[model samples]
Target: MHCIGNGGFFMWWWIASAAALAVLIVVVLLSSVRVRLKYYREGENDEVDASLSALFGLVRLRYKVPTVELKPWLNGIRMKVAPEETSGVLPELDFAREEIRRFVQRVRKLIAHMKNYKRFFADTLKHVHVVELRWDTRFGLTDAAETGMTGGVVWGLKSALLGVASRWMSFERLPSVTVTPVFNQPTFRTEIVIRTRMKVFRIIAIGAMLVYRVLKRRGGWIVWLRVLLGRSPKESTA
Candidate 1:
């Protein structure tokens, strides 16, 4: 009887030990899961709570070309104004021709100014067509490899980018721009359009780091689990 009781006690102790270990593992897993959930929750909350000023405080002038290019060409037509000795008409055609001449001369000066900015000129003169420009912006994730958030790096990037664009168009010589405000959730983008006398092309600077910082907190555990399960993230394209 004593021997049986001792065996039962030992059996119960072993079962208890197994239960304790299982509980410990469960607790550890639950704690890890809780931490991750909290991280994602905090990340999402911060993203939602982020102000437009914070997200887009950094402004870049990505490209500034003469967005509008104008060339001077005569519309082929001649006006004949006649006021002979017998005719009592100071013909309106003469006034119209004079006004057109003045307009052509003004356009020539503007085109010359545009030429001083770019080395290469378009080899064609076409009719004035309005090519409507639209502003596009988005909120999304970018891989960390492609984006950066350092002040010096951004400054250098801004300088180099604008320098190249300046070689293409004289953005500084353009008139003042008016941009309409657009309020968006967590992100905002503004579009400005103007009827310019010169061919003007503009490139808005977009910062890669603007949205990258907000999304880097996901996937360590998921990555581990995938590896444990004999799977892995697919290799990214080179």
Candidate 2:
């Protein structure tokens, strides 16, 4: 019996030894995995070959272009001045703010990813720069209907029908322009009138639609038909 017990004890000791050895091998192999590096830097002003230089050339090609001025204006009588600088700057400011916000978000995500991988960033990361562009614009609109046509020798008369379309409502007239600064980086302030006929129609249509849906839900087909026909149920009965 003693001999049997001694044999079992030796077997367990050997098994434990083998398990420990296996674990040690795994740990060593894991620690041996070194990050693969493409280049090493030992000195400043090191020359890069054509291939290496081309790798970073995309930055230059993708740089943003500056817009000196953007002016969208509506003047008296529906006369439009071809692309001039005396308009409004509010829209441009809004666009710039949105762009900068997105850029910052992207950079933050990139940094987080690098941190996750236990990686180091290039030295170029330190010199990142963002530039903003400013602009001045003006526009005019007149009420003369002018037209030109085509044939062997043809011409068309175009009349300024300011009241004819929604676009003309923008030319209601601005006696003088005023600008006031609002929140955010460069600040935005401008005085301008929104669109006319279209805006009014849009509001009325939306309100009517909402009322129609509500009535239809409560009264079913009877209310819906009346709404579509531009008549109320009470009016139809009368």
Candidate 3:
């Protein structure tokens, strides 16, 4: 009788431990993933910094892009220079009309993907909460009228972005914004910071939804693979 009682007690203890572990997992999964983003462009330099955390700061991560340089190119196209020093291993790069065509095709494919996956993304992003947002911009041009027009365009862009955010996510408070135009000088600068959060469980659910959506269609995996490769299967078929 003593041995049987001991075995029963051990079995109950194991069961209780298992239950406790499951609860902890659920709690962690339900915890919010906090995100912070900062992006800035001043004169010839721009960079982006981002951070993410979850489970009440038990998990944390950060990413930063130091800076980017841009220069005027032929045909009014701007050329991007890597922030790091060049290795000098590769030859000078050139762009042909074919490259421009390819870029346009890729953009079209991206738009199509957005249209197809609109529901999937909406379902995922609806769970997000906007904690804070601020965007400050200063721009100048030789002509005062041009500077004024540019500032208005920037304001419109900000308003559109905030409208989209409000449509998809819950906002804790109104966002702050500022735009200043300097007509006497020729310069451009902008800074943006935003904070948001979403539950880990919601993210998991979104992943599940993606998988289900992909599996539901014929040749979906192939299409998905092609999409990841920056090409469409129909392009290959043609």
What are the TM-scores, per candidate, against the unseen true structure? 0.17, 0.15, 0.72
Clashes of each: 10, 20, 0
Q: Flag regions of model 1 displaced more than 4 Å.
A: 1-159, 172-185, 192-195, 199-238
* Tens digits of lDDT, candidate 3, 30-88: 89999999999998787777789988998888766644433344332233333234443
Task: Specify the poorest-scoring 10-residue window by lDDT in model 2.
Answer: 148-157
Ranking according to lDDT, highest score first? 3, 1, 2
Q: Residue 230 error for model 3, in Å?
A: 9.8
TM-score top scorer = 3
Model 1 TM-score on a 0 to 1 scale: 0.17
Please write out the lDDT profile of model 2 over residues 59-146, one tens digit for every residue. 1111111232332332111112222233543122223444445556544433332322221222221111111111111211131121
| Lowest lDDT 10-residue stretch of candidate 1 | 32-41
The runs of at least 3 residues in candidate 3 whose Cα sits more than 4 Å from the true structure, single-residue gaps closed, are 1-4, 70-116, 142-150, 225-238
Model 1 has an lDDT value of 0.31
lDDT-better candidate, 1 vs 3: 3
lDDT value, candidate 3, whole model = 0.75
Ranking by TM-score: 3, 1, 2
